[model samples]
Target: MLAIGLEGSANKLGVGIIQHPDRSSLEHNKSVTIISNIRHTFHAPPGEGFLPKDTAKHHRTWVALLVAQAMEEAGVTVDDIACICYTKGPGMGAPLTSVAIAARTLATLWGKELVGVNHCVGHIEMGRAITKADNPVVLYVSGGNTQVIAYASQRYRIFGEALDIAVGNCLDRFARTLNIPNDPAPGYNIEQMAKKGRHLVELPYTVKGMDCSFAGILSSIDLHAERLHKDGKRWTDPETQQPITREDLCFSLQETVYAMLVEITERAMAHVGSQQVLIVGGVGSNERLQEMMGHMARDRGGSVFATDERFCIDNGIMIAHAGLLAYKTGFTTKLSDSTVTQRFRTDEVFIKWRD
Candidate 1:
């Protein structure tokens, strides 16, 4: 079956098309046919700090183009698609409404069922599908989230999460302190700086039980930056700085944050009695984090799985795949059931979404 997925929960506006084999799980699992997948994106305001109206407007303006691009890449027309999927909630209301409206309209036109998907579940499912990791602990970190999750009874359970600000939000704030570029993603610039920064400076590291707090860390960093500026010390370019480089800071930040995530993930694994680990979300794309998780998994006689950018970062294919699974299990939302949620807990969804 062909499915078209729309993802506009945050900064990106993506459309994806994927084909699922029409057969039982056993039959489909045994077959190795490469199902086609294609996607396209539109620029959303950087920093993931855009206003709801702006994000929604961007979505309304660009979704059709992205869908068409995905269709072209998939070598199929809109008529070939059998189902339509969209991210439902745990995101900004205006943006979610924009995408949902688009998907609902398309489904109406094509006579297809509109499926609502949890954005986080999409991240995990796509991570699993791409990496083929079975029962792996997931560390989902993004602009608005930082949580340790795992699959249980055919649903994802949140074992640990940030108590305050998200890790990505912390990184973005740090980038702003350094006056880093803000387009595309602030995390990217921070990553680049961390790559060139020297770890001559020590930053606070804090992790409590399975829950972490980034708000304190961000405040501490801000104070430190203020101190540095007051000292009349010249800050050099992260790319060209010598002696102690910005890359060192980048490395330090990546190391500290990723270590926290890895530590929490390990804790979750031990608590859940799961040996395998999987890293999801945009931060999962960081090579340093991947390496740390890999080593941690290996030390425990397990393996760590991470999805490529295709699934690692936010996109539509994952949403479509997750929505497909939900649809197959008779999980449907009535029109009256629609509601946008900014802080919907992953574990809470299991009660209503589990098969």
Candidate 2:
């Protein structure tokens, strides 16, 4: 089965074409081949966040070009496509609409089925496809979402989630406070800084039951950043006696926030009695997070599953794979039902493909 997927729920717009083999060729097992994956990002300047209006414009300007480029790269004709897929929700409204409209246009023009995929489920299915992780606890983290999930009863049930702002949002706002670059991603730049850090500054760690919170941590770190800026950042680290640098703040924030995530994920794993844990979403691309999760999983006698930027960090291939799974299950979004929203929950989608 061949499908084209368009993803633009955030600053990055992606287009991908992928194909799944027929069971007649590969019996008892299935494989997915990514024909093409193209992405275009609309990053804000240092110390700024991307606005919905500007992000929507970016998707509108690049969607057609990206789709054409993906088709060329995939070397596929329009007739070969079985379906058109797009992210449906739990993202910025304007950007989601922009991509959804493009997907609807393509579906209508090609006379193909339209599969509306949940952004979080896209991440989960793509991670599973890449890592071959079967029945693992899922950690879904991104700019707009922070969730710990477990699969049961044809549903990806949420074990825990952010009570306020998501972890990526906290990191991005911290990056803004420090005026760090957002070219690749704010979290990535922070991870780079965290590598050079020796001192761990104390920050609030709020884990309420299974859920976690990051707004307080962001507030605390932002105050520290403000004070350091006022002092020209010449403050001394009490532990190392070395100067407290911005890198230290990044390191501390990562350590604290990641610990909160690990704690909740571990609890979910214990509850679900799953050995493997799969990390998904844009923040799942963080090496630090993967390492920390690996440590926790190992201690529990399990493994941590993660993907690189191509799959983990919000791309079209994931949408294509997940949407195709739904399409194969005889699911298609009607023209009247093809809409985008900012508040679609992860558990809202029924996982009919999974046993």
lDDT of each: 0.74, 0.91
Give the Å shift of residue 212 in candidate 1: 0.2
TM-score of each model, in listed order: 0.88, 0.97
Give the distance in Å from residue 281's predicted Cα in candidate 2 to where it truly belongs: 0.8
- For model 1, the superposed segments whose C-alpha errors exceed 4 Å read 26-48, 228-246, 350-355
Question: What tens digits encode model 2's per-residue C-alpha lDDT throughout 1-355?
Answer: 7889889999999999988885223211148898999999999999999999999999999999999999999999999998999999879999999999999898888898899989999989888888888899999999989999999999999999999999999999999999999999999999999999888888999999999989999999888888689889658756667778898899999999999999999999999899999999999999999999999999989999998898888899889988888888788999889999888888999988777
lDDT of 1 by residue, 86-173 (tens): 8886777888889888988887777777777888988887777777776678899987899999777756788889988889878877
List runs of model 2 lying over 4 Å from the truth. Answer: 23-29, 237-242
Give the winner by lDDT.
2
lDDT of 2 at 305: 92
